[model samples]
Target chain A: MSAQDTVLVVGAGPAGLSAAATIASMGKKAVIVEKEDVLGGAPIISGYAKLVPSGEWAKDAIGRMVSRVEGDGNVSIHKSTKVTQVAGEAGNFTATLSNGDKLDAGAIVLGTGFTHFDSINKPEWGFGTYEDVLTTTQMEQMVGTGQIRCPSDGRVPERVAILLCVGSRDRQIGREWCSKICCTVSTNLAMEIKEISPSTDVFIYYMDIRTFGLYEDKFYWKSQEEYKTKFVKARIAEVTKSPDGRLLVKGEDTLVKRPIVIPMDLVVHAIGMDPNALNPEIAKTFGIGLEKHGFIDRAEQYTNSQGTTRKGIYVCGSATGPETIDDSIAQGQAAGSRAVADLYGQQKVAS
Target chain B: MAIHEKTLIDPDRILQHDHLVVDGVDVSGSWNTMITPRTLTDYEEHFEEIIQSYSGGENVHRCWQCGSCTNSCTMYAQNVDFNPRYWIYLIRLGLKAELMKDKDIIWQCVSCNKCTNICPKDVRPEGVMKATAHWLEDNGLTPKTLSTHFDEEFTHQCIEFGRIEDTEVMVGFFKRSGQPLVQAWIVEFGKRLTKRLPLGQLAKMGMNVVFRPKTKSWGKTGEVLAEYVKAQKEAAHHG
Candidate 1:
């Protein structure tokens, strides 16, 4: 393929890998620029345990995608590097990489995914104050290692409380969008915890269980019925250490119409997704726009689902919003096809 | 005046000290009063299943605790404590002790089916209320309510005669509950009935009450109903 046939794909997570694979299948070259040393973005880099909907371990699932793109001859990988600057229009653009490499590309596809909400932001939940309090990422790491124990003493916790929507849907925190996937992920985690330690009781506290569509029976109901995981309809108010050393979760049991303080051995924040940290910089570099939530803004969703505010510049996955892994991958392919279509269309115009 | 509802805090949880000191500072008086931190741990894991064993309670497990039941309940308009949603939550979580707190008022459900009609989960919370009331009585946590007594009396009348004798039911219920039958309201109702009725219809009604009339077509139906009820009661108790 000619140099102008090359596509610059940013972020080598599930979406980036799929985008690169799609570009390669179209007989075009794809230069994947990943900021991290690893390929499979958050799932592999953040050390996620098991993915939702599919019980496949994160390493195994994302690993397969990484290997597929890695084996393709038309795809070139760039690790620990970023696109520093972009110049010229969509049809003929020059991208300057952080490593002093310049690349010519006809189009750009951003698959930069989201960052996990830090539990430290919500100190009232006792994430930073208490040792047993952990974020979903840390809890996923614990589950990954097959040792679900208190971080402070390494003791097996008898009761664990997972608080959902830690960073999302709270106007106080200025994050009003629902983080879509946490409900199903929390339910899946509850089941996994029960499988590893049958004696431990898992309680998920949430304002709403948004395990939408088919996930209702698969995760939410199954967790209750088979695993005996309890789901409480309450947004936890505060988490404090009890006089007896266990963490006390204070909340109004909305259904019971009573304020309850339950002692738990461990408390987990089922954290939400935030816009990628590099979003503003990426928007500036690519000369695109950032949406209100600081995600990459879309140009027109109806005509071009993957189109960014700038022509021939596509955005997909969690970079646009809180997106699931499977949806992100699908969006990645759409973006790749959009880039290919635009590049061919430009070529025809030139001819 | 607005109705005074019971506070969620148990009286035992409130602690007051005549004299108090903290951090070498005498923060007496109002500062001395404290509410002890209370945590619930005595959850019966199979409480939901137990409730489901009763007739009309088979779908208790399906409730997502949406509060629609409580929001639309007829009795809730009168007393907020009469919450079917709250009871369903307690049952789902197996918080038997938490559920016991509302035992006195659970039988107050008016069987309006408003909650059941409005529920999006098809939880049939009206049935859950009935089942919970029955469960409360069956477990001996609560005494048989007046409504339960009346229901039993009405059912007995229906099965024995293959029809209902309203006067017999009222007398049977009053006798079972040890209430005086010659109440002011009953006397007034009898006077109204006497004033409004034709002589022949009035005589027929008086004869039915005196003779305790039975339907001629009611052969094995009464025995079958009684046997079915006995079998259902046994199943509920065992389950």
Candidate 2:
């Protein structure tokens, strides 16, 4: 296919890169635009530490995926560029790049991912005031350094508290939607923490530990049984600093209706995800709709996870909704196949 | 009184409390969490403005008493009862009495704009605070300590001189509020005591405050302000 028939993909994260790779393998040109100076989004920042299904290292799998996508010659990667304006009808869109360059494409796929809810938004959590209180993203960065030490004293924490549902399932704050990935991600991090520092005590405060689908057994069992991570079915009401420099967590044991106060050396806020700020910008530019939660709105849930109301405008990965890397890759391939089918049908009609 | 069927609930037999209460009836219990359904009639006049100000105020009615806003607010970092979300919920249900009950908190908003900024929907929480404050002031339910002092000071000064005299206003506020005069004029007193006052003529300052120049149109301006207030009250009634 000629370069003019190329598919424009925004974002070079897991989903965008996967879609580009899939399109290139099908002998179609894929032009990928990434706002970041380098490819790989959150995953590259603090490399994945997930438990692979094959019991292998997660870094290996991510490395392989990155190499495969980068090796493709049919894909033209443009870094530090974004689609500022998107106009024209489906099957023919003219996207104006931020650099005054324009690109014509028959189809476009959006894989712009999500951003972590700023922990400072919930200041009562004592995120900035207390050195021991850190968000999950900050914890990930510390883990990336291969050592977890209290920033205040540079000592391993004797008791670590992980508070869940920081921004999820909160109706009073108006964030009623549950950020699906927090449970599994927190559980994984808890387990890793325990394995690294066996002597350290880990307590997870949650309204309910939601481990859905195939992830249920591994996350719930491994964290609770194997690692012996204490699970408290309660919502943390307050986080304060103790006079002795320890972090104090207060919550109610809902079953007994009694308040529980626990002191810890460190507190980790398992903060949830929020829709990217650019979701609305994308919706307005492409004439696509957004759901009430600010994610790109699909025509329907079952049949149109990646399909938008406008033709030739598709969305995958967290741009559509909260999703995992595996799910994002699957959605990318699906969107790629859908674009190819549309192109092939048009060619047949023209011939 | 019930002698027809001879229905007996024996002391030795286990008695069920469910039998005492019937369907759709209020049961006497220690927990009075059952919320009374309130009518929006009292606020029906300003309902359109309130709704428009709060972006329809329909979404706020969906609050399930989750107390997320209370738990999430930074202002609550200092005061727990100062809940922005709860006030919005109360407004949605048109619980004007409850809205008036928390008059102090209605105005305590620091305007950090975080609550609305973090709202999942564009609820515009700051607007809710403004609406609640307006509702309270309209009903004359302002807090005694805070609002009364402010209103008394403003009205007294305005009536005495037809406009506010800043220095006199400060002195009157301190005297009426029963605060120490020393505390009120601590800085001014210190400047005078230290002999570090400005190198300007004291006569100019005295003329500016005590012998302040009067406007030729002062009477007309006062008449115009009174007319404006009257028009506002009439429009509010018609609305």
Using TM-score as the measure, which candidate wins?
Answer: 1
Give the per-residue lDDT digits (tens) of candidate 1, residues B112-181. Answer: 9988899887889988888888888777788766987899899988898999987788899999888998
The chain A TM-scores for the candidates, taken one by one, are 0.97, 0.93
For model 1, residues A1-351, the per-residue Cα lDDT tens digits are 454789999999999899999999999999999998989999998899999888899999999999999899999999999899999887788999999999999999999999888888899999889999998888899899997888888888899999999999998998999999999999999998998988898989988889988899998988876787888888999999988889999988776666788889999999999999878888889999998998889976777789888887998899999999999999999999989887787422211
TM-score against truth, every candidate: 0.77, 0.58
**Which CAPRI category fits model 2?**
incorrect
Residue pairs of candidate 1 with colliding backbone atoms: none
How many residue pairs clash per model? Answer: 0, 2
- TM-score between candidate 2 and the true structure: 0.58
Indicate which candidate wins on lDDT: 1
Instruction: Tell me model 2's lDDT, rounded to 2 decimals.
Output: 0.70
Put down candidate 2 lDDT per residue, A1-351, tens digits, no spaces: 442467888987778878888888998888889898878766775455653233334556666666787788888888899899987766677889999988888788888888777788788888988999988877766765677789999999987889998877887666777888788778778887887788776777888777788777677656755665666556877888778788888777553244556678899998887887788887887888988888888865465557877777778888876777778889889787667655564522211
RMSD of 1: 7.8
Off by over 4 Å in 2: A1-4, A46-48, A51-59, A301-305, A346-351, B1-239
